[model samples]
Target chain A: MTSLWPIERIGFYEGQASAFYNVSAIERDYFEMWYFDNLGAYKSAAHGNLEGVEQGHRKMEAALESIGNKAREIRDISETERKAGIEPEPSGLWQTGAYTDYNREHN
Target chain B: MAAAVIYRIRYIVCLLSMLSLAVHTALANEIPAQGPFTDSECVSCHSDRNPELIRQWRNGPHDPASGVGCSSCHGSLHADANVKARKNQGCTNCHEGPASHSYSKSKHGVLNRIEAHEQDWRKPLKSGNYRAPGSAYCHLHDGDHDDTMSADRGPEVRQWICVGCHSPRYVREQFANGRRQLDIADLKLTEGKQLIASAANSQTKELSKLRQSLIYHRRNVLYGVGHQSPDYQWWHGQPALDGDLIRIRDAIE
Candidate 1:
C-alpha cells in the first residue's frame, strides 16, 4: 500500500476506529440525546426524586466515560499490530471504520 | 578493429532492451493501485480545488476528529455520469453497525434502504428528492457544503428536509422547544464550569473526578442534543445536563 505523503493515513484510521467504538458505546449505553426533556436535575434542587436523579446521573457519567475507553482500545490494539510492521488485512477498513486506512509508502 | 566495435554495439543494445522491459513493468503496477486509488487521492486535489469539503470532513460527525475521506465511502470510479458515494450504499458500506443499528433500523432508514428505488441519490439530499432520510440527509445535506449560504444553524438546519412531510407549525414548535432545551442545558453547563474554575485544590484527586465528570459529560451534552433522535422522546435528555450540573454544584460547594 502506498501511503500518500502528508495525509497521516494511520492517524486517520486511528481516529475512525475510535469514532466507531465511541458510537458503538453510545448505542450500547442508550444515552438518547434526541428525546427526553427536563426532570431529574432540575428537580434535584427541590429534593425531588433525589435518589433516582443521582442514579441516573451516575449512569450517564459511566456512559460518558466509556467513550474514552473505546478510543483507548483502538490505539492499544493497533499500536501492538503496527509494531509488527504488517499492513492491516486488506478488507479491514469500513465506513463505520477500521483500525487503519492509508497505504504504507514504499519509497 | 571493426569487429571489436560491432561486438560492443550489440552488447549495449541488449542492455537497453532489458532496461525498457523493467521500466514498463513498474509503470504497469503503479497506475492500477494509486491514481486508480480512491480515498486520500480524492482529498489531495479536492483540498486545493474545494477546500470546504475538507472543512466539512474535518468538522462533521463522519470525520469527527479523525478522517474518513472521499474514496472511503465513494469508491474509486469517478466520471461524468455517476457518483456512487451519493447513494446510501456509499454510507452503508462502512456504517453497517453505526447506521445499521440506529437509522438503518428506523422507518426512515428502512424506506431509504429498502423501498425507495430510483431515489436519484445523485440528486442533492433535498427532502422531496428522497423518499426517506439517509446518513447524509440531515448531516451532509447542505448539498455541497455543510454551512452553505452561511445557513441557519441548529434545528432549522433540517427545515427544508422536513417541510415536505411535516407542517410548518409543527416544525416551528419543535425547533422552538429544541432550542429551549439546548439553551437550558448550555446555561447549566456554564454554571458548572464557573463553579469548577473557582474551586480550591484544582489539581487534587478529589477535584479531578468532578473535572473529568464535567468535561467528558459536557461533550455528551452537546452531542446528545446535536445527534439525530428517532423519537426525540420527551424529557429523556434534559436530566443528563441536570445530573451533571447538580454533581458540579455539590462538588464545588
Candidate 2:
C-alpha cells in the first residue's frame, strides 16, 4: 500500500520535509554558496577545521555537493508527486531561505 | 440773405428730425413675428410650464431697471412663437462688445454654423426637463441682478460662470474691484483701483488709511457666479491680481 503522506504542498516547511529536495527549481535563489555549505554541516565535526585547512575546504565542498544533489532529488520527487495529483511537503533550501543566493545566481 | 438763412435752418431741422426718427425706429421697431410662439409662447412647446424664470426675472434686476425681458435675447414671437422664428439674432440685436467679438471664436458658435446643429444643440438645452422658474436664465445671462454688485456679495453672484460675456481676461476684472459688478470698473484695472482708492479716501481718511480700507473692502469680490469664494480668492484671485499688478509695476519701471 502507498504511504498516506500529503505531498506537493505550496508553502510547506523545508526542514521538516525530506532533505533531498531541490529548493531552487522555480524561485530566485537568494542563498550564497557558503550558506548552503554551512547549513549542510549541521553541527557535525565536518563543519570544524580540525582536519587541516585544505581538508576543511574539501569537506565544505562535499557538503555543498550533497546539498545540491539532495535538492535535485527532492525536486524530481516533487514533480512526480505533483503529476500523481499529490502535494508533497515543501523541502530544501528554497523553503528555508538556505539556497536562496545560489538560486538567484543561476536565475 | 434772410431767405438763404431760412433755407439753411429748414435743412438743419429736417436733418435733426431724420436722425431722431431713425433712433426712434431702431428702438421701437417691433420684434419680427417669430415661430409659433407668442408672448408666453414658450408655454405651448414647454407645456405644464412653470414660469420659474419669469418669477425670478420679476423679482430680479431685469424687470424694469435693466430693460431686459425674455423677448430680449430670444426675440419676440408676435405671430407664431415656434422655435424657428425665434432665430439666433436676439442676443446680437443689442449686446455689442468683446463678448460678441469673442463668441464668434468659441467652438460652440463655430460648430453652430453647421446645419442641424440647432437640433444637436437643443438636446442639452431641452433635455434637462428644466424650465427656468421665470426668466432667471435671462437675468443671470444679462447680469441684471438687482443689488449693486459688491466684492463680497456672497456665493449666489460670486460663482457665476461669466465665460459667456467676458473672456478669462475680463474674468480677472470681477475680482479686481473686490466687488462682483461686471460693469466697467471690474472690466478695467485702472477703473478698479481708482474706484477702490476713491472709496477708501472716504471723507475721513489720509491716503495710507484710504489704501488700507481699499484693501480691506476689496477682499470680498467673487470671480464668477458659481463655485469657490474662498478657494478662488486665495488660490486664483488674490495671487493672480497681485502678480498682475507686480508685472504692471515692473513694466512701468
Candidate 3:
C-alpha cells in the first residue's frame, strides 16, 4: 500500500516549483538581453563590423546554456521525488470549490 | 498729314478693342460651370446635407475675404462633388513656395514605399498606416478637416501639430507596451527592467528599421520642410538620431 507523502516533502516540492518560476523569469530577461545584443550586432554589421554577428550568437548560446542548467536542476528534483514515491496533488493555491462551482453554473 | 494721323488713331482703337474682346473670352472659358447648382444653390442644398463642411470652409482662410469660394477649390459643384478634380493643385495655386515644393520630395508624398503600398489619397488614409504627414494630414487632423479654421495663430501651434506623434510617452504606450504584453503570452514581466526586456524581445527587425527611417524623415526632412525651420533640421534632428543610435547600441551590450 502506498503511503501519503509527508507535508515537509510537499513543501519541498512547492519550494522547487517556486524556484522553477524564478528561473523562468530570469530566463526571459536573459533571452531579451540576447535579442538586444543580436539587434546591436545587426546594426554594427550595417556599419562595418564583420565579427559582430558571430559574437552576438556566441553570447546568446552562453546565456541559453546558463538558463538550461537551472531548468535541468528543476527536472532532476522532480525526478528524485518521483522515485521516492512522491506525487503532486492539486493544491488549493490554484483552485477551490468556488471557481469550479462558478464554472459549472456558467457552463 | 492730318488725314494720316486720324487713320492711324482709328487703327489703334480697332486693335485695342480686338485685344479686349480676346481677354474677356479667355476669362469666361477659365471659369468652370457648377453643374446644376450655382454658388448660392450649393449653400442652399448642402446647408442641411453637410452643414458642418460648409461651416468649416466658411471659417477657414479660404473665407469670403480671401476670394476662395467652394467653386475655387472644389471645382464645379456636381450632384456628387467630383473629388478627383479637387487635387493638391488647388492648394499649390495659392501656396507656391519652398515649403510646398519640398512636400512632393518629402517621405510623406511617397508613402507607397512604406507599409501603405497601395494607399489612395482620394479616400482618408488610415492613422495606423500613416508613417508621416501628407498635405491632408498637416491640414486636416484625423479627418477633422478644420485645422486651419480652428488653429491658434502662434509658435505653440507647432507643438499641437507635432506632439500628436513625436511624444515618446505616447509612442511607448501605443506601440511598445501592448506589443510586449501580447508577444510574450506565457511569461509576464512585472518589474520595470523585465518590462523593458519584454519590449526588446517584442521588437521586430522590420518595425525597428521602419521606426528608424520614420525618425529620420520626421526630424530631418518633414519638420524643416513643413515649417521652414532650418534650425530644427540641423541642430536638433541629426544630434537626436546620433544619441538614439548610441542608446540602442549600449542597450545591447
Task: Judging by lDDT against the true structure, name the best candidate.
Answer: 1
Worst 10 residues of 2 chain B by lDDT: B126-135
Classified by CAPRI criteria, candidate 1 counts as: incorrect
Residue B25, model 1, lDDT: 94
* Model 1, span B1-253: residue lDDT tens: 9999999999999999999999989977553333455566666766876797787776655564446556566656554213465566766777664234445545666677776575766776666777776766665664554432123564554665567667899767556554644554455456556666766745666567756665555444344333334322112233444444444444444
What is the per-residue lDDT of model 3 for residues A37-84, given as tens digits with 9 covering 90 to 100?
Answer: 667677777878868877766776776786688678768978999999
lDDT per residue as tens, model 3, B1-253: 9999999999999999999999989977653454755567767766776788778767776666777766765565563343432245556677665445555545555442353445454555234434565555557544443554143754345345555657855543333332322222112111212322434553756436534543553334334434434433323333233233223332332
Q: What is the C-alpha lDDT profile of model 2 across B1-253, one tens digit per residue?
A: 9999999999999999999999888866544334635545653333334455455556654564577755565455444322322233444466444333334333434444343333422222221222221112222333333422333455345335343334656555434433432221133234224434334233333434434433432332233222223333332333333333222222222
Better of 2 and 3 by TM-score: 3
The 10 consecutive residues of candidate 1 chain B with the worst lDDT sum are: B228-237
Pairs of colliding residues, candidate 3 = none
- The parts of candidate 2 lying over 4 Å away from their true place are A1-107, B1-53, B78-88, B115-124, B128-253
Query: Model 1: runs farther than 4 Å from truth?
Result: A1-107, B1-68, B79-84, B87-124, B145-157, B215-236, B250-253
Q: Candidate 3, B161: how far from true, in Å?
A: 6.4
For each model, chain A TM-score? Answer: 0.37, 0.36, 0.43
Computed on alpha carbons, the lDDT of every model, listed in order, comes to: 0.52, 0.39, 0.48
Q: Write the per-residue lDDT of candidate 1 for residues A1-107, one digit (tens) a residue.
A: 44555544321121111111223323423444111112444456367777766765765566566646755775887898899886766431111111111112210
State the lDDT at B64 in candidate 1: 40
TM-score of 2: 0.27
Q: Per-candidate RMSD vs. true structure?
A: 23.9, 32.1, 20.0
